[model samples]
Target: MIRPVAVIGAGPFGLSTAAHIKASGIPVRVFGDPMVSWRDHMPAGMLLKSTPAASSIDAPRRGHTLADYCAAAGISRLAGVEDIVPVGTFISYGEWFQRELVPGLERVRVVSVDHRSAGGFEVELESGESFTARAVVVATGLSGLSHLPPELAAAAADGPAPTGPVSHSCQHHDLSRFAGQELIVVGAGQSALETAALAAEAGARVRVVARRRVGFGAPPWRQPRLRPGSPFGRAWSLWALSHYPQPYRYLPARTRHYLVRRVLGPLGAWWLRDRFEGKVRVEEIDRVVGAEALDGAPVLTVRTRAGATGRLVADHVIAATGYRVDIAAMGFLSHGLRTRLAVSRGTPNLGPGYVSSVPGLYFTGLPAAASYGPVMRFVCGTEFASPRLTRHLVAAHG
Candidate 1:
């Protein structure tokens, strides 16, 4: 049996966890290609909804901040309309951060994780190698399955999910693929609006579809009301997101769920009555309820608030519906280990410092999201999650 100090995914959260654990002088083994999903899955030309300062991951060393990297690259630390967080820029920063801080990433995909008899974990990878770690931290972000509405799902199975005709906002890589075709985008969150903009720029007849009319807003996460100046901020202790552990990191998943749905969710959608939609067609209060093959191409059956059904045919369909964290979907969570881990709302339950209810099984990144609010799901969330998680892991082993 191989038991390591820790195991983690290699996105910002995973790398940050490894960095903190390794920095504490503990032996850790982490798996996954660093930033592979971020580099590939996220659409280009999308600006981060949250600005740089509000979305910082924790940095153990003073100079490891994105601000520092920006300074070094002659990029402004401040991200404005002209300069936004490019996936490549953040991907490069993650790589540089890995090289500088978390050098333990194995650049391999973990296939399965099993439980050892002695209260430890066994991690098997795509390379057919195995590692034993006292603790295994699952940080695989966005690698979870992206779900589509029933209509879109049916169309995807019949053929290629619409290309220029329709596409899930999540699966799109190139807007040019929809060039010169009619497109209808679903959702009004940043992804939907941004993808709509991207498609329109590519010469496609683009229309945005949303269940409710959504107006774009500057992600209010940075507003003075949400920041340190507010008493609410002081109570939540989120003002130290870049430097300290999130207070919710230790709270129960149920508590966090309430906080997120009641607090963060409304706040996330409250901004943008008059931003981001520049000449884009937004079909407010519409939903895609069905998809049928119209002469071999997909046609979306649309339902509106008035209960009337209409159709929007495109060459493709892009579902920008957000991802869901089903514990059973994690590629590396073997049946044996998955059974052993505690469950919280269909996810592996985690505690403060990202400790799983199952000993030796910690979670980082998206897996920690329910308990950490929206914080653990973002790149910047790593900054807070790492040091707090590492301190406990290091103390236990070091």
Candidate 2:
């Protein structure tokens, strides 16, 4: 009997890949709470940066798009690039997709995955159940990869918590708890800007500190029409990056890494511009040099572009600095297996079909960004990743 393929996550990539694999008549086991990250890590009233047209999860069959979910659930239809998708609506869509297509998904945690001496992998779940799989796909998106700057890590010594003196933006699900408090949000990205806007709307006095000028994407109506549209945005470069990710792995390592980080860099959604401007204070600084807890409050020492230094104190400091993909941080992989895998800049070095150096071991989502370009970092990339990965699994193992 062929052992089932083990899918280690339940987000867009994992669910999409599982649906495709199962559609090909391959036995598979998917493990994780459906849309757990979008439901738990993000704030209650938050909106996705991706436009409605780019927010659907990839499925092997038709009628499983976000539009289908909205129509069936009686929610307002979302079709345009200008339409903003609420996190709640997207989560519900993901759950609906799971129910309709990937119904056998296991809502349990996979504790560890280790390679067997003979072949294949041994997967152990939190429930003390163990199983063997012909292959393993690690689609755990940004779960344990929150990147907190070293300057602010000391202030958050208590670790990331919603109510702590200093915390990462991913720690909060409800910004209402911070009402009436003073907040210092660090970063110019969507997460930082949107978190500041939400906190201010919740009655908190909010200020955003960034290393450079904050930027907002132009409204859909204002965008130039000459270039083709891709999930990242409308640009020839973005179009190529999103449509031809397979060639991305062939590029030099430095170029791939630089493009992944530089493309789609820190910028907020156009709709958020009105809510953020004038409502939240913005300060451009050289860098955050230090942070400390003083008198039960967080104080940040920052340098200016002009070489001047100053300190700012706030009731709480949020490090909305985003995530870094480090395979080592995925504690589910045993030390022996991790050291055997080839990685570049903390990301797995993936080949065709998103397979890593170790055979039968694959990664997708944020972790695949370095090898597959910035497209893998968004929900829309699953359209490219899922079908190709399914084909590889069927041809190799089936």
Instruction: State the displacement of the C-alpha of residue 138, model 1, in Å, after optimal TM-score superposition.
Output: 0.6
TM-score of each: 0.86, 0.99
Residue pairs with clashing backbones, model 2? none
Model 2's alpha-carbon lDDT is: 0.92
| lDDT of each candidate versus the true structure | 0.66, 0.92
Candidate 1 least-lDDT 10 residues? 264-273
Cα-based RMSD of candidate 1? 3.8
Q: Mind giving the per-residue lDDT tens digits that candidate 2 earns over 262-379?
A: 8999999999999999999999999999999887789999999899999999999999999999988999999999999999989999988888999999999999999999999899
Candidate 1 per-residue C-alpha lDDT over 217-317 given as tens digits, one digit per residue, 9 for 90 to 100: 34335455544531123334445433344566567657776654444332222233334356478776556778766665668788878889888776656
Shift in Å, residue 147, candidate 1: 2.1
Most TM-score-accurate candidate? 2
Which candidate should be chosen as best, given lDDT against the real structure?
2
Q: Give the TM-score of candidate 1.
A: 0.86
